[model samples]
Target chain A: MNVKDKYYQEVLRFWKDLTPNQRELVDHSIIKKHFNKGEAMRSSSDQCSGLFLIESGQVRAYIISENGKEITLYRLFDRDVCIFSASCIMKNISFDIFIETEKETTAYLIPTSIFDKLSKESMAVQVFANELMASRFSDVMWIMEQTLFMTLDKRLAIFLLEQSNIEESDTIKITHEKIANHLGSAREVITRMLKYFQEEGIISLSRGTIHIVNRKRLEQLTLY
Target chain B: MNVKDKYYQEVLRFWKDLTPNQRELVDHSIIKKHFNKGEAMRSSSDQCSGLFLIESGQVRAYIISENGKEITLYRLFDRDVCIFSASCIMKNISFDIFIETEKETTAYLIPTSIFDKLSKESMAVQVFANELMASRFSDVMWIMEQTLFMTLDKRLAIFLLEQSNIEESDTIKITHEKIANHLGSAREVITRMLKYFQEEGIISLSRGTIHIVNRKRLEQLTLY
Candidate 1:
């Protein structure tokens, strides 16, 4: 099968029980696009770009503050579906969110008009949309809980551990500025905390990278 | 019309274009209940309770931290619909949320089985459910933004102004502890901030009430 046919199969995986008419609608409406690393895929001010289903690589969804600080709401990887990019169809989601490619990525785009129509006509599509929405809400709520209730040190510790898990390496190749952006904190604050962690023999920091020296101590910090 | 019939009419306002079969299903399946102020309507550990449609009074949905601190996700007033109470049906919303009455409330509930069936059969019902979920996600995102990006003093000012608008009075009848709970901060932090605001002449505190003495300054504080 061609790449387009394979992508169509992937789409069907999400709505496996779609009726013949719904399947035809998706086949006619779906579009595929590729994004380079660090590319802006969607913006709050732009026209609603529609729902995106990641085929490969990853993308990050985040909100920017007035002073330009960014806090990631969540990240979508291969086989993940994103609804916030098409948030305009979802009534009352007024706040602006931006989606950017974290790595070279290819994704299927279902235009808002088609998805909206399909959702109105197909129960399967609607259920998928609601599940996607509910899951995103849970992600955002988790981030809010971390920001509100946890101290900066604990949050940093958690972030470091999470990055280690994601990279599958003790050495995480990320900058202090990037870490601050992820945690919605200042770079200097993150730098100071990293210094403290290093002093406490929890983690060692090198130029543009963080190495977990004491994974157990870092895990202990994340506990209440 | 009786109260139950009146609520049925209100439900129609949401799914106004429902077909006869859908209307009949809702009429027979909807359940009505009342909750006194401060009553616990639902908890994280309880079974799914389906969707809630508030007819009168108010309710708050929140998440509790491991250390027992509570952070409100959002609140529902008259005519508002709640989906988090039926989160189990959404498939991926695994977090625990608690719902409690903030005021004596009368509500209509569509049990999970019926709502699930209706949403599958009726496009109108599915549309209404998706809209309800989207609106709630937006509400939760707004709170997360405030918690992550805004300063506590600014958030407190915005909260006071919002309370004044809700009550249509300059004096807000709430305690520091309640404010802390809503903002997801320690009571001592809120108390200290309130004292600072009092010294700044933006507000005057008396007992459990806070009077906005300088509305202009308080509003200015919320501006970037």
Candidate 2:
């Protein structure tokens, strides 16, 4: 089947209650796009791209501080939706976010004008859009809560475990700098913490990878 | 005029395009409620309280950690709309937020059932609701960015400047514990920082208030 047909079966299936007119608008405006890994797709300061419904692969949405520190807001995987890419259509959303393809990603993009039109004219589109926005808000709030309340060690522990789960391996092929960027910490701090963890027999670090020596200990660090 | 009519003129005036049926639904189900200062209006673990359209006074929305540390997400003032209070209606929103009256607050609440019905049936209601949600998301994201990227001194300086602007006075009638809660810091840390600020001749601290001694220096600190 063609990409549009595939999109219709995958993304449009969620909006089964949409009117014929609304469906027509989506069909006429939707475009399928591909990006290579590490390609920058959108930035908060750039023009708005409409909603993205991921068909495959992965994307990381993040924000860069004035000082050039970056932190991940969230990640989008297969079948996930990114509404912030089209944030320009929302009047009150002032902050900008950056989106980059973490892997070779394919997604269906609904242009901003079409999304703005449908969100105003169709209740189904509105509900879908609002739910996506609310869910994203919850995620951003969770990141904020962790930053505000949790110590660096706990957050790093949680991040390592999460990375292990995502990569489905006890050894994570990630650099200390990369981990620092994700956790919004300095590289030296992360390195020091990792060394301390190594001494505690919880983890062992190689040149560019970390292998969990005691997964239970790492898990316990997250709890404490 | 009665309270309901006042609410119609004040809050519903912005939603002029709402259909008569939608208007009737809101008008019938809308309730005007008053909250005394310091009253806990809603918690994440409690029942959803629908949407709040502030008529007067102030409300603070915050989240509490497992260890009971509280951090302010955002504040709602006159004419501000809070969509998270009715987050229960949105299926994918899993986080709970707590709302309390920072001052004696008067607000008109749209019942969740009525709001859900109208949002599904009326495009105007959908737009209004979505805009509110998007705006609140922006606020929460701004908070997250501050927590992740900024130093405690910079955030404290910004907070003091913001409080001065809001109160229209250089002397803020707030305690260190309250400031800690708002900035998501410990009382001792806040006290130490306040002492530093006082030593720097930026501010003066009393038993229950902070008086800005040098507004220019405080502003410069935030810029730095």
Q: Which number leads on TM-score?
A: 2
**Sliding window of 10 residues with minimal summed lDDT for model 2 chain B:** B6-15
Question: How well does each candidate superpose onto the true structure, as a TM-score?
Answer: 0.91, 0.92
lDDT at A146, model 2: 80
Alpha carbon lDDT of residue A184, candidate 1? Answer: 92
Please, what are the lDDT tens digits per residue for candidate 1 over residues B1-224? 67765656675455556676776787788889999999877875665888888889989998888888988888888888877777777777867789999899999888888777777777677667777777777788898888878899999999999989977899999999999999998999999999999999999999999999999999999986
Candidate 1 residue lDDT tens string, A141-180: 7888888778999999889988898788999999999999
Range of the 10 consecutive residues with the lowest summed lDDT in candidate 1 chain A: A7-16
TM-score of chain B of each: 0.92, 0.93
The stretch of ten residues in a row with the least summed lDDT in candidate 2 chain A is: A5-14
Off by over 4 Å in 1: A1-7, A11-14, A19-25, A44-47, B1-7, B12-22, B45-47
True contact recovery of candidate 2: 0.85
Candidate number achieving the greatest lDDT relative to the actual structure = 2
